[model samples]
Target: MCTGKCSRFVGLALLPLAFIAIIVNLLLIFPNGETKWTNNITMQVWLMAGIGGAGLFMLCPSCNAIRAGGKGCCGEGCCGNRCRMLRSLISSIFGGLGSFYCVAVSGTALSNGPLCALTNQTGNAAQWGYHFKAMEDSYLFNKTSWDICVQPPNIVLWHIVLFSMLLGLGAIEFVLCAVQIINGLLGVMCGDCRKKENNNA
Candidate 1:
C-alpha cells in the first residue's frame, strides 16, 4: 500500500513507462510503415493502439496532479487530484480491457503456433507448415512455423520468452491501471470539490 506521496512518485515514474509502451505499441502496429503493402492490419494492432492511447491519455492528469504537489484534492484527506482520479478510473476500466485484449491476442498467437515461422519457399524446405485459427468468418488468424526439411539448426525456444513477456506486460499494465482507478476514485467524489470541501469544513 503506497501513501499519497508514494503514489505520486509511482505515478510520475509510470509516465515515462507508459510513454515507452505507447511507442512499442505503435511500432508493433506499424512494423513496416514505409512499405506499400503494409496494410496488413490485425486485431492485435487495434488493441495495442488502444492501450497506447489510453496510457497517453492517463498521463496528462497524473502529470498535472504530481506537478501540483498533490493539492488537487476533491475533499480534505480523501482524494489527491480530481483529474488524476478520473484518469485512474478510466485507466483501470479501459486500459485494463486493452491489456486483456493484448494478452488474449498473444495467447491466440502462441496457441495457434508459428509465432516465428519462416521458410525458403523456392529452396529445399518449401513445405512450410501453415498454422491457422479461425476465430470467425471475418477474423481468420494465420502464421507459419518453419521448414523442417531445410532446417539443420534454427530452433525457436525463445518464443517462450516472447510469450512470457507479452503476458507479463499485460499483467503489469492491468495492475497499474487498476491502482490508478482505485486511488483516483477514493480521492474524489463530487461535482464541485471546493464547495464540498468548504461544506465539510
Candidate 2:
C-alpha cells in the first residue's frame, strides 16, 4: 500500500511523462505548421492513433480509482482523477482532428492535379486572355473558386487549429495534475505532523 506521499510523487512523475506524450503527438501532427516531409497522411493517422491509445492507458488507472471512491489512488488526489478525464477527452478530440486533416490534405492534393491540367491546357496568358476574363466573371459569383485558384495548399490552417486545441487541452491536464500532486503531498505532511504531536502528547 503506497503512502500518500509516495502516491503524490508518482503522480508528479507521470505528469511530465504525459506532457511529453502530448508534445510529441503535436510535433508529429503539425511540424512547422504542417506535416513534415517525413510525415504523410498515413504516418499522421498512425501517430494520432498512438496518442489516443497512450492517453487512454494513462487515464484508465486514475479513472478506475475514482470509480472506486478513492482519492489519490494514482498518487494524486481528486486532481489526478480530473487529469485522467481530461487526457481521455483530449485524446478523442485529437483523433478526430487527425482524421479530418488527413482527408483534407489528400483531397486537396488530388484536386490540384485536375486544376493544374486545366491551367496548362489554357496555354499562354496572352492567348488565354478570354479565359482569364471568364474566370474573373465567375469570381464575382463564387469568391471561393477564385481563391482556390490563387492559393497554395491549405493544410497549414487545419494543422494550426488542431494543434492549438491539443496544446490547450494538454495545458489544462498538466495544471490539474500538478495541483493534485501538491494536495496529496500536503496531506501526507499533515499526517506526519499529527503523528509527531500525538507521540509528544
Candidate 3:
C-alpha cells in the first residue's frame, strides 16, 4: 500500500547513495595538487560524479511529479508536462555524457590489464619507473608508484588501482541509469493507478 509520496521518497533516497559512493571514491586515493598522480583517473571520476549528480537531481523532481500524476505538489505548474519533458531531456543528456565518460575510463583500464608492477634491470621487485628514483638509495627507500620512477618496464600499481576504481564507478553509473529508467517507466503507469484508486475511494 505504498503511496505516491512513499515511492517518491524511496527514489529520492537512492540519489544520496550514489552521491555518497562518488564522494568516498574520490576521497579514497585521489590526492590534491597539480601533480602527475593527481591528474591520473581523478579528473575522470570528478566529471562522472558531476554529470551523474546533476542528472539525478533533475530526475528526482520529475519522478515526484509523475508519482503525483504529471503535476507538482506546489500547484504552481512546477511539475507540468513541460517540466517532466524538460527534466527527462536534462537527465538523458547528462546521464548519457556521464555514462560515456565512465565507460571510456573503465574500458581503458580494462585494456591495461591487471598485475601492474615495476622491476629492476635484473627483474627484481622495485617501484614502477626508474626515472622516479633519483638515485639507487632513493629507489630502495621510496618504493612507491607516486614517485617519478622511470625504471625500465615500470608498471605503476597505484595507477592501476585507481583505474580499477574508475571502472567500478562507471559500472555504478550505468546501474543508476537503469534504475532511473525503470522508475520512469513504472511512473507512467503509476499515474493511472492513482486515478483508479481515487475513483474507487
Candidate 4:
C-alpha cells in the first residue's frame, strides 16, 4: 500500500474521534448540562483525559501525519521517503500514548462513578460524595440504586454513557495508531509505493 495514502486515511479518521472525545469530556464537567457543582466534580473528570489525552495530544500528531501524507518531494537521497516514514512512526507512537491515557482515565471514572449529593435512607440528611462507589454491587446494574444520588438528576446514567463513549473512542484511536506504526515501519524500510510505481512506469 502507499504509505502516505494510508497515513492520510488514518489521520482523517482520528480527527473526528478526537473531536468527539473532547466534546464528551467537556460535557462531563457540566453535569446535567449545568455547572452548578463544578467544585465537586470527580477527580477523573478534572484530569481532562478526553480534552488533553485524546484531544490535543492526539490532534497534533494526526495533523502532522495528514500534512506529511500530502503529495510532496519524498526528498533527495538520505532525506527522502525514509525520513518522512520515520516522522510518521514517531507521531503514531505519540497518538497511541494519548489514546491509551484516555481509555484508562475514562474507565476509572466510570468505575468510581460520579460525585454528587446523596440523601440518606432516613431522608432527613443529605451530603455530597460518591454514592455508587461505596456499594459492593455495581450501581449500573441496579436501576433502583440510582435514586441515591439525588442532587444531580440522572447523573449516574450521564456518567455511564459519556465515559463509555470516551473509552470506546480511545480504543479505536489506539488501534488506528498501532496500524500506522506498522505501516510507517514498512514505508521506512521499502519506501512509499508511489515511487515504485513511478519508477516502473
Candidate 5:
C-alpha cells in the first residue's frame, strides 16, 4: 500500500515535467521565423490542435486519480499532503491557461482563411488566362480552370470541434484536481486528529 507522504512527493516531482511539456508545445506551435509551412492557415490550425491535445493528455492523470480514488498517494505527513496539494494546484492553473492559449490561437488562425483564397487568385489568374487560350490552340487543351480553395469547411469545422473538446477536457481536469487537493488537506488534518487521540488513550 502507498503512503500519503510518498504519493505527495511523487506528484510534486511530476509537476515540473508537466510544466516543461507545456512550454515545449507552445514553442512548437509558434516557431521562430517566416517559412513556407508557417504561412499556411490550415497548418497552423493543426499545430495548435496538436499542442492542445498533448497538454490535455499530460494533465489528465492527476484528474483521473482524484476521481477514481479519493486520496492520491500523498497520505498524512508533512511532506505528503502539503506537497500533493501544491502540485495539484499548480497543475490545475497551468492546464487552464494552456487550454485558453490553444483555443485563442486556433481561432485567430481560422479567421485568416480568406487570405488563402485571395492569394491563390492573385497568383494564378494571369498565368491561367494566357494558358487557357494557348491550350485551345494545341491538341484538345481543354484548359479547365481550377480555383484556389480552402480545405473544405467540414475539415476546418472538425479542427474547431476538436479544439473545443480539448479545452473543455482541460477545464474538467483542473476542477477535479482542485477538489482532490482540498480532500488531501482535510485528510492530513484528520490523520493528525486521530494520532492525538491515540496518544491520549
Candidate 6:
C-alpha cells in the first residue's frame, strides 16, 4: 500500500476511537449517571487518561499524519519525502505513547475495581474504598460480586464495561499507530513510490 495513504487511513481510524475513549473516561466521573459520589471517585477516574492521554495525544498525532499524507508542498521541493516521513514517524511515536498510557491506566483501574459505598456492617452508613482490591479473582467474571457497591447501583458492572471499552480502544489505537510507524519508515526508505515509478517510466 502507498505509505502516505496508509498513514492517512490509520489516522482516520484513530479519530473515532480517541473520541470514544474521551467520552468513556468522562463517564467514569459520574457513576450510574449520578454526581453525588463524584467527590469520592477513584484515583483512576480523576487521572483523565482517556481525555489527556488517549484523546488529546492521539488527536494531535492523527492530525499530523493526515497532513503528512495529503498532497501539498510540505512533501515536495526543499521539504522532501524523507523529511515528511520522518515527521510522520515522530507523530506515530507520540500516538503510540499516548495509547500505551491509556492502556496501562485502564488496566490498573479494572484490576483495582471501583470506588463506591460498601455495605457497612456496624451501622447503616456509607463507606467508600477500593472494596475489590483484595479479591483473588477479578470481579469481572463473578456476576454475584457485582453487588459489592451499595450506593451507585450496578457500579461494578458499570466500571467493567467502561474500563474494558477504554482498554480495547487504546489497544486498537496503539496497533494503528504502530502500523503507521512502519509505514512511515517505508516512506522514508523508499522516498515517494509514485515518484520512483514515474522516473522508471
TM-score of each: 0.54, 0.33, 0.47, 0.90, 0.41, 0.90
lDDT of 1 by residue, 1-201 (tens): 333453476467556656655655554444333232124333444555334543564465456435433545554444445555565455456656666665676565455433222356565433333222322321122223233322212222222334445655666666666666665565545322443555679
Clash number for each model: 5, 1, 10, 0, 3, 0
Higher-lDDT candidate of 3 and 4? 4
For candidate 1, the lDDT comes to: 0.47
Question: Candidate 5 — what's its lDDT?
Answer: 0.40
The regions of model 1 sitting more than 4 angstroms off are 1-3, 16-69, 73-80, 115-123, 128-158, 189-201
Q: Please, what are the lDDT tens digits per residue for candidate 4 over residues 1-201?
A: 688788788889889999999999999999889888677788999899899889988887687667657654446334446666777789889999999999999888888888878877788536888877888998877889887788777788888999999999999999999988998888778766766676789
lDDT of each: 0.47, 0.38, 0.43, 0.83, 0.40, 0.82
Q: Write the per-residue lDDT of candidate 2 for residues 1-201, one digit (tens) a residue.
A: 233333344444444444555555555454335443233332333445225533433454233223322343364343434443344334324433433443344333222221210234455222211122344243333435442332123433343344444444444444444444444344434422323333579
Which segments of candidate 6 are over 4 A away from where they belong? 72-80, 122-125, 196-201
Tens-digit lDDT track of model 3 for 134-180: 33343223456333333212334443455565556556655555555
Candidate scoring better on lDDT of 1 and 2:
1
Q: What is the C-alpha RMSD of each candidate to the true structure, in Å?
A: 7.8, 13.6, 8.9, 2.1, 12.1, 2.2
- Pairs of residues clashing in candidate 2: 7-75
Which portions of model 3 miss their true places by more than 4 Å?
1-10, 28-82, 113-169, 178-192
lDDT of 3 at 185: 47
Candidates sorted on lDDT, descending: 4, 6, 1, 3, 5, 2
Better of 1 and 3 by lDDT: 1
Query: Model 2, stretches more than 4 Å misplaced?
Result: 1-39, 42-54, 64-153, 191-201
